[model samples]
Target: MVVVKGQDTSEPGGVPAHPAASASADAGDEAAEDDRRPSPDDLHELLAERGLAPDDVDQMVDVAAVGITARWWRNTKVEDWHAGSAIGALSDVDMYRINTHTTAKVRERLRRWRREQGLHTMVDVADADPAPLNRVFYNLYRWFTNPNRTLIIGTTLRDVVAQTLSNARTHPDCDVPDNVTTETELEDYDNQVAGAAGYLLESMDEYDPRSVLYSPALFATVWARRWWGLPDYPSHVDRVFAVLADPGHRTWQNRPIPPPPDGVNLVDVRKKMLTKPWELPDSVCQWLINDAAEHYIFD
Candidate 1:
């Protein structure tokens, strides 16, 4: 059997049709093409699998209206906004990213990053726990389009949840869900990012200067952990080891790390953890942080 972009192109008697002929045949078969497309029922079934009610689509639209700033969604397209259902919005997002000038290498990095952040599809958003309906709507809309901050450091779903929880901790008026993330989960996530930062610090010289690690577009990534409330390396390193020492701890189950030298069995360490700690001079690090804060993160 011959396959092109996942479509079977084999003809009768095990002979493969010419690629152009196959394309022409497929394009001419309107009823077959329509059959191939997902129906409203199919979309509803997908959402239902994640426990979302049909009305939840409206909630998703409202969230996207507020959270998304892209011109495609925000300006002169209000009709299109309402016309496009939740799944259509996701499809539009996918197409926009495909049409953008982002390099293939960067797109692959972003794909991996999104997978790491626990975002793969609308279903994944609906599956995030703790009041999955509302929280899922938030996740769906927040990640529906690529935010500029997404390319910045410290924008993981865990980081966002932790930050929201921390803000609520510091300020009583912060409007966040009561069960978005527990304090224990917050601390666990903090340690995970810190250990990743420590790993990056240990592996800095191993990367080439031309690599994404040194790219100005992602300069803020070097200090992502700090932006997400891990302020100092020594303290961060201490937390990492502290988490490591607790064999029963919950931090490494999802984000695994290397086992301790003392034969303490631990989860397998994944290659090239995404966290990056600055190896630059203090002055340069300060400047980069200030620049990102002033011009990138908040803008």
Candidate 2:
């Protein structure tokens, strides 16, 4: 929600034309007003003063400072979502950082936003047996806050689509147990995953396995956000693809995707996925922005 510029301050049952409707307002004052807003560093001090955990004030707020308010493409919930989730991860001492880091006052307010009525998907990477990381390749992905989460990836490329299908069919309980299945059997593996995704698509009546693939890569985020009452979904689909396409994505790093096996329409696969509906929390955008500005998510 947003207040329009030059909108009337008066509310029918809301605030009196003057100012007494604030939750933290004083007797004579309707709402609290500050002469000057605090800077990111100042906000850290405010949260520290209020007893918030140091991580909330220092790291999270520091991370959030990367975002500049975008009024044009309005999306209040996205920013609100960050404020609520970050503050919830803080210690009581650092609680005020919500006010310091962002304009939100409600500690866990974003958890139950009714606007979350739309369908979405998520993939939890369940500590799959990754091949290996190169020297320059950092296991750059992992949830520091919530360790037990899954990650997902979307692809209908012949190899990827087939493998997703096989995953659903051959290994009915694919994710339940973690194992290193040899890619030595690439053809057989692709056939399996393809079968799985295909099977799920056939049954629209039940939960589609598509949800699993479409919404991959938010394991660490979804669980933590879920704890705070917010649905772990991105504000838009392009965000999902941007992340999936990133060189840091596991799919790109795990094992180089071999050139689309002979005659596999790579163009069609890319178009299909790029045009498909996907969602992800705006925190990732904030991250890219932060990285661009601060050199990285953390110093």
Candidate 3:
């Protein structure tokens, strides 16, 4: 990152013309040092050297401001703004009082200073993956588009129930009642199945029923606390299975067999079973089988 400085007049030859040019070259060297990654301690040291107090720094600088100018500079293909320019923006008096503010505050101030210098984006200083900065950009973008808009977690128990019903309906062997259309109807069905599963789980305590639900290949682990009884335990297990079944869910594992319309043949499904057996109840497997069958048509 080259720091732009005032152009110096050079002699007719390639050499610098005067002693002032030598001083400028030295300042450029210092500026190069300033171009290194900025940290809280460095900012504090720079301010203390300048004799700025905390209150003085805050009054002159908006420490909370994002480094927009720095980002803009980088985006526009301008000379990189180094720390020297960031500190140089402050008045000598304000610069002297930099120690009074917290490190975080000073960091923000420096970031903002970089922004004021025409660096408007976070990517200007970002050394590696700009994911965090990208998120900030996204939030700002969202805010600008709709000030009243707020993010909400869309997943709900109703959604889980609906997903489970969808899975059952698509399964080759599982029997799903026709009347279970609405979310309310699905929830009732889920409750019934979960109750039965819970009873079975409790009765068969000698066997770790979870072994059936645990698929190492799928990276699926349905955890339940010891204190949780049948209905709750079964309900949670159903939820986990439902999540795994839906590709729309983030936790859904990618399978060699795609979803319906393409329709995977039984041979491929059997192959998948051998490699990564579905760790779910027989009832759940019925839905998975039906779902997998939809992905491809059999000969």
Residue 90 error for model 3, in Å?
A: 27
Taking every candidate in turn, the Cα RMSD to the unseen true structure, in Å, is 24.9, 25.5, 32.5
Q: Which structure is stronger by TM-score: 1 or 3?
A: 1
Instruction: Tell me the tens digit of each residue's lDDT in model 1 across 156-274.
Output: 33443344345445543333345545444433333322322222222222321111111111222221222211123234434544564554556444544433344322222111011
Worst 10 residues of 2 by lDDT: 66-75
Candidate 2 — which residues are off by over 4 angstroms? 1-34, 39-42, 49-58, 61-299
lDDT of each: 0.29, 0.24, 0.28
What TM-score would each prediction reach against the true structure? 0.18, 0.16, 0.16
**Model 3 alpha-carbon drift over 4 Å, by segment:** 1-36, 51-67, 70-75, 78-299
Candidate with best TM-score = 1
Query: How many clashes show up per model?
Result: 0, 35, 34
Q: How accurate is candidate 3 locally (lDDT)?
A: 0.28
Query: How far does residue 8 in candidate 2 sit from its true spot (Å)?
Result: 9.2
Query: Which pairs of residues clash in candidate 1, taking residues 3 or more apart in a chain or in different chains?
Result: none
